[model samples]
Target: MLKREEVESLVEKPAPQFVRDVLEHPPFRVTPNTTLETLVSYLRKFPVDVVPVFKSVFSDEIAGVVYPHTGLLIKSKKLDVKIRDFINSPIIVKESWKIDNVLEILASEAKWGAVVIDEEGKYVGVVTLRGLLSALLLREPKAKSVAAVYTPVEEKKSRVGYVKAIERLSKIFKKLAGGEVEGYVVLNREGGVAGLLTVWDLIKSRRWFKGGGEPRPIFGRGAARGEGRAVGVARVWRLMFRGVAVASPDTPVDEVARYMATTGLYLVPVVDKEGKAIGAVTAWDVIYAYLYGPKEGREDVEVKRAVEIPVAKPQVEEAIRLRPSRHVTGLRARDVMLTDIPAVNMRDTLSRIRKVFLRTGSNILAVVDDEGRVVGFVTRRDYVTYIAEKSLGYWKRQKGKWLILREQAMPGEQAKVLVEEGTAADVMKSEYPTASPDTTVEEIAYKMLAAGTDYVVIVDEKNAPIGVVTKDELLKAFKERGRSVKVGELMTPADIASAELFSSLFSVIRKINAYELDGVVVKEGGDIRGIVTVDDLSLRPVEESLRGERLVFFTKSGVLRRVRAGLSRLRYSKAGALMALDVMRPFDHATNPDADAREVVDRLLEQGVLPVVGDDGRLIGVLNKMDVVKELARVYITYAMPERLKEAERVEVKSK
Candidate 1:
């Protein structure tokens, strides 16, 4: 409304409460014409996963963001691949934007780096977490909650596998995401950390757009069974950035900080001398620890100290309890109860329950009563088992494709009805442990170990739900004991079960189940060749063997009956190639007997027991995940809990 000079004088000089503050130092940027080689080199130079893409050299206008991880995911080559092929249009912003809002974008799992543009759309500079942290160094992170900063990897997260497409690893990642899953831990065949894959690495997993490459041929491995076919899925071994870097618990915190800062790693896994991952530390953990750790318990605000123990105590009573407890220490029902539980209602449908799963990103759901008291428990696996059983029942009733079509075509059909109507009350198991918050942690640990459950619920004085105690928490209770333990000490050393590589799949599955073993190995002339898992054989039968028109042509529009399917020409295409060697993918994980108990437990926590190697690298024993839990529970309660009790008493007295 005023003259230009008057308006300029009246309006105060612009100040930045946004990325422009940290971007005062002109940040790094790439151009759409940047080659993959040069772009990758630039990315390595900066401490961020993504780089801003400018429109051109002269304009300095930001077009989008380019992620280096995208390059890692592509298997095809365009001889002419350039930055333009992958840059994502960064959510545009103004020079006067608020940091709180901009942070929402930078904090997203899908986004970590963004380009800041002037109101005119000119590329101002790029802002990243690294820059944010650097700008934030002068301000103490005292108010940040403990969970936001601490990164701990209980023994279970150390599990790893050979590189596979992120799709193959999605289910496991989902299960882990429900809890505190340490992203993808890639291990070579020998069970050593190889490559790491985090959620960010997977954000751009889309196949190179319209990228050139013929579909990989199935059974291209020169199998004796399939003369010509395509069978295999894409793997990410080549795509995964390799060279694992691990730290030890004793490694100085500063050293870990420096390592993470330089590498731009969010997670730095702690490894033992033998290269077994034992724990993990995050970059933020170091920042919070150094800048604000000393200000804990100041009474200004609720503060979670470096170790927010599962069992928190009142300051005065807590210090007193740390002293010796002369009273009898029989474990009660409350100490280890789960105080926080994620639950759904009884009448909730599968679709509704799934909503809760997505929102919370958890696998387990506790069904509760009107009073919020524990009533039942459910997990992602329960839904799968129920669906599989229901499908089996339907298949038993409806025999063929024609019947399946009719049943699926209409509503209120036979498949529409279900026992319990797929309600929470139907799928939830009511046979879980319940206790007050005061129950002895030992009792709960024993129950968890015996029932093979990962958690137990905690109720209040009014019999209402309060919390939940998980297996990982109990593992923390045994933290000190874990340090002194060895895998050989906890595992039941047993002979390795085996069969020849060329054995029939049926025979291999038989041995795997009959021996009640973790898994069996494929051998050649008394020498170890590879490993096989039970999962390889339990898949759908060979009826749908041939792809494209080959099988359809022979079956005459799929009219061939189930019994007659074997007689069709499709049977000759690649059906019985299900020999053990051909059907089984080589086991990608393993551990040695001398490895630490924590590392071994991490591997065992996954579905199968890893092959226990001797110094000579021959399988000698198997450490089942459940078996380890059982043994640890017994030893930990009888041995470890008592010591913790003593320490608790001592701490209690000191506080008093």
Candidate 2:
């Protein structure tokens, strides 16, 4: 329960002229006359998510918005010929316009955010749906309403050693108990929000499982005294380390929050598990989800204000209801995970390790073993501290392999100088944290902060690493993979969770965002069912269709890349055909199964004038790029898009 004034204080008011205006110059503005290739490069270099495409002559007037997706499309085709080719007409509004007016336009457009224009009709800034909602939450409410709270749960927390668990749990209780939540539910093996126990529940309950258990050290010291058996499982695992509540990749945050209110739980785990921990959802996550669009309510209806009286009413008469249809949009792991995340082998050389450390803009690298499981991590400071402590001679004299130069290496010496075992099994941080494929961006961020690790390992059910995540990867995942794909493909889907939608989404997103992937596929019964990208189910509203479109483009690009590769392979094979063909077929010349048709053909053609040398050789089918391309063209034209014009005569045009 929050006071109205308290909520109001958090809401951001309309941007004012006094607001540290970036009016110095509106960053970079592109015109329709700009070449598409140049535009693509421009956008890539610019930090702005969008570049305003203004019409020529007017210069100040915005004609359309050019975003990365559209730019990528043009660039992929080598058709980034001109900006006018891809400009999209966008509805523009002024900065002075009330937030309510902006909301009306957004609802109608079915868009997540809007572009802001200045009085001169020049593009100035953009307003997001969430930014506006945050502002609204600050306004006076009709009444005080009870809502749920959300928190992230680490799917596979570094086996929090017993001692650390106790310490961390103690600190958690001290920090979380007195704050916002009424009572938190402890999730159990069933993946159900079990036991609505609160601080008050602990205080008032008279029964103790262990004989005469004391108040403060609920499970820490008690287990030690009680025959070495773990005691107070609830307090130790559930109470201290919160279990992320479950959510589906498609579950609406409003619905989750409403469910939380009914259950009196703060978080919902978005799991792909049948029944287990995966990812998490929170009250605030839902709030932000709704803040972006109509999925929360009927977003298009306009509000009419009482100008004569001091009344602030929404322009639209849409009702806000917590229902199943209120799906979460603009949220996915792709929106947040970092892209081109750094990774390393467990047995990488110290020199290489040092290079990666210095070269990477990020602070850490995901250290994976031969099997690709994350084993350990190395940080810049870790290396820096080692260098400060160790002598140069100590690293130079005592090593066998060039990869290993050490006078005498101490165990785990200066985290950075240590040799990677190279095997996926060795040197990687096995005792590390993880997030499910469907974990929300916010949840992953919290886990990364709490765990104090930049890289998270994405693992499958058997604990095999699928991908690696860093803070930067998480951001990229949120931006790209957030819309369509699930955690399974995006993450290393594991039998980590029982087959359940909620568990699947939670676990997948957590893993994807934690490890920073496009998104993860949700697994159920040890198979992929759905995909959760950082972008698909998170704060950014990049669409799933956009992802598919991108994949199609990439697939097309891959086809081209693959074809070029095949051609290169063909060229190599062409030169050594005779000798290699003889090696492949040691037995019969006429019966040989491995040979080049072109070489054989040339031999036959030349043999008409000169006697054929009886070399032991075999002949395979002859095909070349020109022949293949010709066939492709014929087939493609035969089945291609229907033409309105009359069919032309079928003629074969021989190539020179």
- Among the numbered candidates, top TM-score falls to 1
How would you encode candidate 2's per-residue C-alpha lDDT over 337-376 as one tens digit per residue?
4434467887675556645643453455667668865566
**lDDT score of model 2?**
0.36
Which ten-residue region of model 1 has the weakest summed lDDT? 394-403
lDDT of each: 0.47, 0.36
Which candidate number would show the highest lDDT if scored against the true structure? 1
Which residue runs does candidate 2 get wrong by more than 4 Å? 1-26, 47-49, 56-58, 75-80, 118-123, 128-272, 275-656
lDDT of 1 by residue, 240-278 (tens): 434334444444444444334333445655545465544
CA-only RMSD, every prediction: 28.9, 34.5
- Shift of residue 653 alpha carbon in model 1, Å: 30
